[model samples]
Target: MQEFEPATDQLDEAWDAIQHVADLQDAWAAINPQGEQQRLDDQLDRNLVQDSDDEFAEMEVPELQSRQNIHQGDQPRCAIETCDPEITEEQAQHMMRQLNEKQRQVFNHVSKWCDDKARDQSVDPFQMFLTGGAGTGKSHVIKCIQYYAKKVFARMTESAEDMTVLSLAHLGTAAFNICGQTICSGLKINPKSQKEYKPLGEESLNTLRVKYRHLQLVIIDEISMVSTTQLTYIFGRLQQIKGTYTDFGNVSILAVGDFYQLPPISPPTPLCFPHDEILKDIWNPLFQIVELKEIMRQKDDAIFAQMLNRLRERKKKQPLQKTDKELLESRRVEENNLTAPPDALHLFYLNKDVDSHNERKLASLNTEMFTIKANDVDQRGGRIIQVHETPHRTTRADDTSLASYLKLAVDARVMLIANVDVSDGLCNGVPGIVKGIEFCNSQNMPIVVYVKFDSDRVGAKTRTTQFIPPHYAGCVPIKPRKESFKVRGRTFTTTREQMPLKLAWAVTVHKVQGQTTDQAVISMKGLRKSMAYVALSRVTHLEGMYLMDYDESRIFCNEDIEANVAKMPTCDLSKANPLTEIDHNTNFVIAHHNIQSLHRHIDDLKRTQK
Candidate 1:
């Protein structure tokens, strides 16, 4: 009021300064939400704030709760805390105790009575030959020995030491994998030069040898599958690699298998004789032979097993017609004629018609069939058919409608057959149901009837079509038919290697030679032949083989029994032959010399290059 002359200018300056300060505050608040939020709204997006709080709170509670739970009680114990109910600890201890006693007695006897030479640090290695009938506990006993060795080694050696176990097979991909090492049956040596071209490096074979050198024992399963030549090669390689390490080299090798099974395939010669030197020397004094007599797999059906055993022992002689054989044959024929609800039949023909000019004309109808063989069907009356010519060829009266007839016999069953003539002609056995029929170009022009074949045989469901020719244009599907019959037929003989062309009824023994069957109705008549003897033995179990005739002589033969007994080599492991030590030393020395020569040759090459 006192400075009224310049009051207006002073008031304007204050107002402008206040406005600038307010603008600066607003810009700062915009960058920082918490500060702006307080001024903007009292309840600032409660949903967003509460959602985050709930998540973090939930996480915190669970962490604290879990910690508390862990502190509350100890973890649940293993199921094996107590002895197994089926086998008590006492029983196990008793069995183990007996085994241990036997082992100790043998060890004591060897330690006391064995010659001073045998007691030397360089004790000649002992080999074991374990043979057994199929399903015996041979493999189990060897596995037990391996387990014992592993335990003993673990107890004797440091904890850091490694161990390996291996089981090798004769063929295919089933091989042993242990501690980064694999032992397979066959080596891929060049056929022309039976030399080991693929060399093992220091990192591969040498490293494996080092890691497993201390291995106490090795158990070889299915030893029967190993050829004598292959065994000798493997043994030679092992001896060469471990020759320097006396302590680690003296590893135990246990082999278990049925000797009566298939033998090794050897090279052909003018006179057929066992060419395998190893096979001949299998009964060498170094081996400890153990034969397992207990049959485990066939224990459930003892009677049936005994019956099969008898049959296996029987000799091949003259055919004997028995009541069982007649009954089996009759049953087979009856099964073939059962054309009931589940077994429906359908037939298709490749209709061929010639024009007035004597020229061959293709039919408009076409079909294809797919068939799966049934195990019980009679060979003569079942779904088998022999095609006289290619499916494309013109159908004649004597052309043999075998395929067509088989299709009519079996109803509601699927059939798959190959080879169809014209694209427009009738195609039979192609999977799929006919949906609809239509014609194009001319109404009378050969109607292309499309047939779809449905099958899961080729992995997934598929549909294929065929074009019908003008000649068999009249062929059409029945309309609104109930309880329709679908016939299934198969072409027995074909030119293809995979497909068999001829189908005929034969005794099971004749057909199943060198083949395996889950269930077979074998005729006693066929059992008299040598081929039948081979066929019956193909099955692994007695239950797998069925006999049609129950003749004592058919199932058990004195000659066959004698033959098996003769095959069992008299392996006297206790006695030592004079040539044994000499042979072993000779083999070892030869291998050593060869290895030295190889090393010298390599060194010379390297020096020359430098």
Candidate 2:
């Protein structure tokens, strides 16, 4: 036991190793319960003190306890002076009391799901699929469930690590809102090409086992953006890592998103493909589906909400009423009013237009401009790849990855591309401007971009360590990682060291989903029908939108995926159906329905939300 006690930094490492062994034991027992103990005893030798040929339990905690200390750890790392602490469950409860009936029902269902998990130690976690359109409180419900899940697990488990849950999403912005990370980053799965993914490499398996063996739950936001191939890749990697054949390695998965939202960006996508391939692959026997019926985002504007419903349902585009239609159309017709709305983002369908708008704004401001070259060096400080580094697909500029050449100007509009500090309100998609800059005292090169996000000042680190892009045709480093600047507030620390800000004067509509603004003008060309609804929904009211022109094609989208997903067992809820009965005595926890009331309550929620 004395020999097993390692350095402080290595405590979790040792614990993780033990956890992996336990994972393997569980998997082996499931396979052959009669002889698993002996088989495990015979195969593992290094550091494993097992009875020669028959043993099921071991005394390992005393070794880790030989040197144990606990402190209040900040969840989201800040880049500056104070550590940003997570909201306590008590605080979350106070906020949750604000949810309407439909929102409350969703929370209650998730609470019971997790509560059942706490009561049963032998049963695997039950998977949950929460279906809702924008403003149905999908994101809000996710936070509430996360809060309650943590509360239940903390009470039931002795080991804090055992109660841990993984919160993940498909993209940085989506992940940021939920205080999570990109699925690609969390699963350590490469999204470069569907054909090139290899889940069973020795080092890869070892890495996955070490990182996720003890994790019991996963919550994925923006399931709409996740392709079937990506889902399969995640499930496959988890199975290999945990040595289990169960979907998600027998871990419970809670997926949240709108089925009719924008389809995935790549292949094997629109997960509801022919023959229900995606459902069969990742969501099946244990999967539960809950659909939210409320349109909380526009609760205050019922007529406008109805207009949106018509757009999504592809109803005959009827002429607007004399009052609202004239005001909205006049706003569109008066091109001058659309040109210079204060604090309005000029949305576009093409990158060229976005780039052109950014260039013009930069030129007009004529602020002091500075550029920082990324540091891509080896252990000895020698350049690794001198030319452009195209990170598989995840890190490429074309596919939402950071740019190789990032030009920054003081007073320029920018968005945080990563979760720099979650507790301090520094999240992905948070817009800000470079208030000032600091250069190397001697080198006279830009070192820190002093950014004012809303109000909090954050220093964006320009160089830090990060995951290296995987090469398809060449041998990659055995470790396969790189260095980039990261914001490490005094409270938390992370290995990621890359600058997290990107220019945001204008951006693609896809980049703006699930976000709202005071005013926005969209160029509807080149966008899908669903994309139009997503873009249109971002504006709170008709007065806030300035459409360059509307085309019939803009409101039509591919319906194959929607039709496929609809066939899955579903529980839809609205005021008419009422979610009241199911909250208490419903095993149909998989299907929940509660469309938010499209009343005046929305404006109140928005005021409190900001």
Candidate 3:
């Protein structure tokens, strides 16, 4: 240690304080920003930082701007000065007047909240957690806000700077439906990594810094499927890349999902408020919470909506009325009606069952099966397609057995798994038939499959997708769903790719969430729990629901299957021996009381015939 240069009398105390400040600045200056940020981010992932305001104030950190500091990416959106809202309260009310009373209320609440955020200088942008049951217009409200925000920003400035108001989803189908990027792609996750908690590497952090430099608002749809650990990283990494010490770095986060729905397959983590400490920390600060009660999809059928609400909440069921029980029973397609053109959409509880059923159906059709092995290669250009087999746990593509290869016959009932073009109605769950295929050359390797969506779905037009293989290195424009999970003390990655089409003759209930079917035959054999209710709710009307070999007990999901893993951050910080087994079992639940509105209000539910 260097000998201290003493100041005269009381000046020594002041000299020591000044020396400490210089030392702190020098310490920060010595470290690389990117590495320091990553270290801090990882620290956030593993600890609940308990710094007092005064402690942080004493640090020699650079002062961050209240707004417009999230990112400037390659594209700069509107300047903060020019992005003020012009929507008057009257205009907002007028725009939402077409919605139902409940919808209008939620819309107005979110509209005004977003409006204030657009003009306010509180540092944090607009954020929300919009939750609701199926058909509650969660998606509708998101779209409305997206449209309104654009108009407000446009009216403020003439220059279009690619002001991004984007939607992000945990899965490819959801992202595609919203015309947005997947969380994995946006955040820079190494899909091939064998680690469950893949933090953002420098490359990923830098990429996010550039790509989303101008990112405005982020809407995470289907939040239930995203694990808490995954979300923790998203929050922490975004803050790190944006260089803001504030929560979410002053960027807005609109999280939309129903916990009653299925959670992410691996780790099977469903985000619950307050209970999940890490998620709670990420959600700290100003976020408008909105739960839409009215069922916009089933607006005319108050009874159906009530039943769904009760079922979704897992409430103790009241004795079924004789007529109500008969109504559900009568809707079950007997052998005579089962084979009709408007066949019930088959819902299977197991992946194997769905695969075997669809395969058998296609085999029985007496058509030639075309097989296309996926084109997979390592970074060195060596083919890892078959050479390096990844141990599979459970994922959307793994369950289908199409990540490596896809086999299909013409005229098979199918569902478009990826969005080909939303404008023309090429979207997930649009039940259709595979009309034919076009091969690459005379050698007859498959290229594109022509599909004709149901007239009721796409207004009678053919949609075509060029068969693209998954570049494990992610070379192609199309990014397949990357499913990560843990098995036997290591993280493993599995990519599901090639066929954007899945057999529609039978689909898993989780696959069919956020969809409506005129008729559905839900088989409840071997269900984990409460998923039967989810399957049953897909039918637009009660009369269209069919149950095959169903049991009432299995209709409620198997609550025992839910994983009770300790919080990841806490686990990482603990001193004791860590959990050797990380169970990625697929179990889910929303242990909340029934919605009060389920007790139908005669006045509130009176339907108007349009």
For lDDT, candidate 1 versus 3, the one ahead is 3
Best-to-worst order by TM-score is 2, 3, 1
- What is the C-alpha lDDT profile of model 1 across 138-246, one tens digit per residue? 4334433443344445544455456634343332111211111112312221111122222333333465466555554555554544554445445544554465433
lDDT of 3 by residue, 26-133 (tens): 355367655754655444333211111101121111100000111213111101111112356555434444466555555555555556665764634656667778
- Clash count per candidate: 55, 21, 12
Give the Cα-based TM-score of candidate 1 against the true structure: 0.37
> Which candidate ranks first by TM-score, i.e. highest?
2
lDDT of each: 0.32, 0.55, 0.52
Model 2 misplaced stretches (Cα beyond 4 Å): 1-85, 161-163, 193-197, 200-214, 275-280, 284-286, 315-330, 333-340, 371-406, 416-430, 441-445, 455-501, 571-610
Q: After superposition, how far is residue 264 of candidate 2 from its true place, in Å?
A: 1.4
C-alpha TM-score for every candidate: 0.37, 0.66, 0.62
- Tell me how far the alpha carbon of residue 521 in candidate 2 is from the true structure, in angstroms, after superposition: 1.5
For candidate 2, write residues 1-610 as lDDT tens digits.
5567547568756754664455544566798764753443233212111111010012100000000011124121111112122677556756587676667756666666566777876765667788776667777777777777777777665566553577877755465567666666566655442543345555545766776656667888878777777777777767887798877787878888876776676542565554243436555444567877778778888777766665665523444446644444555634545553534666776666777777777767767776644433221112232322322222232222234456778777665554444333344455655666556563323545555444232222211223323321111111111223212221111122235556667777766665666567777777765777777777777776778765545665455655666767653433222334445444543332653553534553343321
The candidate maximizing lDDT is 2
**Superposed model 3: Cα runs more than 4 Å off:** 1-95, 155-161, 190-207, 273-288, 316-324, 334-342, 364-366, 371-405, 415-432, 440-444, 452-501, 557-610
TM-score of the candidate numbered 3? 0.62
